[model samples]
Target: MLVHENLARLLQSYLSAGLRSWVQINVRSTNQFTYSEFTQLLPNPTITLSFKINPLPGICLLEISHNVAFAIVERVFGGPGSDAQPQRELTEIELGIIQRVVRDTFGPMKEAWRNVAEIDPSIEAVETNPVFIQTGGPTEVVAAITLAVEIGEHLGHMTYAYPYSTVEPVLSRLSPQSWLADAKHMSPSEEDSLRRAVQGAPLPLTTLLGKTRIRLGEFLALGVGDLVRLNTRVGSELPVFVGNKLVFHGKPGVVGDRMAVQITRRGT
Candidate 1:
């Protein structure tokens, strides 16, 4: 259940996008967890959605607090979306709306994980009692993400949990480093943006024409315009360095009135 931090970021983006599309409201994922920790975070009387993720052996859960769920239902009915304290079970219409929310959210959830996994997430059931819906055992680990949803005048939380057993199949592909490396190659626009940003950076370039050993006494005796013999031949290739690191072999030359180094070999 040790999810890559990049995966958390990806989920956040998709969750925000998915929620906005369905309700036309803001939803921000502000927290995350591994399954073992998630069990302790669950609140009583919340709406728990169990999902059967195909090809993965276990169930995943998405939980929404009553306040947030009621607010969403109220808003969908063109109400003012104020906070609601639901003391009773949801009505049939409310349940339908909640189901729609779950179904709509799956698109972005699946999209976010497309790179790491092609998860087919479908709702198995919706429950009000956390005791009845077992996300995992007390010590079981899972990847979990929490969202802060805004509806009209209220803000509430929604949490999603995917058990470690369920995600183990694709865990290797979810490493943050690997994901970043893949992202760099997958998006040409991102590559261009990176290149453009680095293009303006200034580096100190130096061409070492030659080197010679000399005593301190001989060095101090030197004067301006004095000819000092070098260890290199006139036609030899010089080593070119950028910030003290040798990057190329070049030949010292004159370019249109300016002294320059014509690169002959690039570094490995």
Candidate 2:
């Protein structure tokens, strides 16, 4: 769970944005469970979907309740998205609606998974009963994310399960810290964009009037009006520093009412 907390949060954000754009619905992550524990939590007559990840040769499961499916179907068809749970399996129209929802979800799902690996998931089949599906062995370990979906006034649960084997090859990249560390290396375009962004940023500049060491007692006894003699003469060009780096040489003078430095030479 320690390693997954960050990934979970990132996935939650991606899914939230994806669903909001596609269906105008909101989703919140309630909890996570292991595969064995999650299977035991499935309700009877569950809407089970088997998904296949291309180029990885792996399968996963997606589950939603009948109530949630019905609500989504209603909303997709320009209805109020409120109704009693249907007693039968999804009809052709309902299935068609759900298929679109599933297809749209893959975009964000793949993007959230990019930190781990590039996967293309497609729903192979949808089954009403979990007993009829066999995406993996009964004992296979998986990470299941439980989501609280809100469609109108009805609230429903949706679960997404990913088998450990499916993402094992890229597990090292899945950690949030690792993913963020990798993000620190920017592409040339990104670097250029960032450089442009900070080009106008302000910097503090200071002139080196000169420095002279004094005894601790002598410095402590200095008075407000006392003058401390410096090593440089009054008319000598002063080295200018920008945040500690000496970048220019300037001559000090009084401009209008304030003292100023006019740049005379650039740093070598």
Index of the highest-TM-score prediction: 2
List residue ranges in candidate 1 displaced over 4 A.
Answer: 1-41, 83-87, 136-138, 184-268
Poorest lDDT segment (10 consecutive residues) of candidate 2 = 1-10
Native-to-model Cα distance after best TM-score fit, residue 225 in candidate 1, in Å: 66
Model 2, 132-158: lDDT tens digits are: 777676677787766555555566766
Model 2 misplacement above 4 A:
1-37, 186-268
Local distance difference test scores for all models: 0.67, 0.68
Q: TM-scores of all models?
A: 0.56, 0.58
What overall lDDT, based on C-alpha atoms, would model 2 receive against the true structure? 0.68
Model 1 per-residue lDDT at 18:
41
In Å, residue 209's CA in model 1 sits off its true spot by 48
